[model samples]
Target: LDGRTVLVTGGAGFIGSHLVDALCEGCDVRVLDDLSTGRRDHVHPEATLFEGDLCDEGVLDAATEDVDVVFHEAANASVARSVAAPRASHRTNATGTLAVLEAARRADARVVAASSTAIYGDPTTVPVTESEPTTPLSPYGVEKLAADHYVRLYADLYGLDTVALRYFNVYGPRQACTDYSSVITTFLEQACSGQPITVEGDGDQRRDFVHVRDVVSANLLAATTDRVGEAYNVGTGDSVSVAELAALVVELTGARSDVVSVDPRPGDITVSRADISKARAELGYEPSVSLREGLTQLVVGD
Candidate 1:
């Protein structure tokens, strides 16, 4: 990305901010975020910030101008919020993605967009591959699927260069600790606060939690690779149950908090492990961070 002009929508958010920080050293990075769920302070000092709604035509126009590549990360990312307000989510996740595609095409720039594993819903198999049929459960999942398909379609139909990354559960610093936050963030907050660590369901539900740094690496690889019009699963190719994760958190944090089971969220996937062989072969992507190391950093860094 050296000497390249890049635009990162949602660059103030967790994953996007990290991407911005990585690109700022060698590329002309411009961040476009609405601040709805993103923090202004998270954006890198070297990058320029364009604060506006992604669906706004004028905002998209200004953000994409003169850009060589665009990382489309802006979206209404909450599943619960999307379930409650599907229309609003559609406008952002689905329609907003189309706007970005059009802008990237107009700018004659390549596009790499963020996708979600939620598009697979509860997978029928253990390690979900890219070829698996999409069976989204929530409105957020549906919208993300729509966005993912639109990106690949634009590449084929308009001859635009585009790639979509179907990211698994991504966790790292700058990830917000909220009711809707990732399980890792929530567990960390609870453990640090000396509160009971809550585990949804029987705690046997498994997930592939990839670190933000690895996800950033995947993005960088996607941008430079000739693998266009295809989607790749970005993950560690490993899975862990919620019960195991909670135990590890307690051990790492050394918190005197009890681990308790709670009601599971409806339609939660029982198991999710990424089949990243395609990413390895095509994008040359590899995950370097271990779950234990990632948790230790969060606990000790705090």
Candidate 2:
């Protein structure tokens, strides 16, 4: 990737910032973010930052100019928030993505779009695969599915090289506490701050937690691979319940806060896991971070 001109849309956010870090040294990186959820401080100084929305054609043209590869990572990622504010969800997650695709087509840049497992929407089967029927429950899922379609359509219609990565329960450092914050981030913050953590609906919902670092690796692979008009799952191929995660957090952080049960949030899935066989075979992507080790790292600041 040395000497390549790269653009990351949400480069100020968690996983996007990590992608920027990896691409900054070897390439000329440019970041375009609206600063709605992403922080300005997370971006590196060496990389240029463009403050604007993806729907802004001027911003898109400026950011996509002379770019070789585009990582379209910006989206409204919260399921519950989407349930409450469906229009805003579609605006940013769906239309915003279309705008990005149009810009990529004009600039003739390869794209790696960051998608979500929410597209599966309460999978009836365990370890959901890309072939599973998509029946998204929330507006967020609908928006994601729309964006995924747009990306693939651009690849086929415009002959653009594009790949979509569906990340499951991504968590790690730099994750802020917000409405769409992961359960892991919420629990860690509460436990470390000596506050009780709330677990909704008995905390028995199973989830496949993949670390953010692994997602970054998958994005890098997507950029280099010659694959186009394809979507791959990025996950650890394992499962853990929210109750188990909370218990582990308490044990690791030694927080005195008790785990309390609460009413479940709407649009929350009961169970989720990923079937990552395709990504492994094609991209040689294997998640190196274990849940225990990842939690320990957060506690010890390693």
lDDT of 1 by residue, 1-302 (tens): 89999999999998999999999989999999999999999999999999999889898999899999999999887888898899999999999999999999999999999999999988988799999889999999999999999999998999999999999999999998653438899999899999999999999998999999999999999998998999999999999999999999999999999999999888777999999999999999999999999989988984
Task: Give stretches of model 1 more than 4 Å off.
Answer: 179-181
Tens digit of lDDT per residue, candidate 2, span 262-285?
988766788889999999998888
Q: Supply every candidate's count of residue pairs whose N, Cα or C atoms clash at under 3 angstroms.
A: 0, 0
Pick out the ten consecutive residues of candidate 1 with the lowest summed lDDT: 174-183
Whose lDDT is greatest here? 1
lDDT of 2 at 104: 89
**C-alpha lDDT values of all predictions:** 0.93, 0.90
Instruction: List the pairs of residues colliding in candidate 1.
Output: none
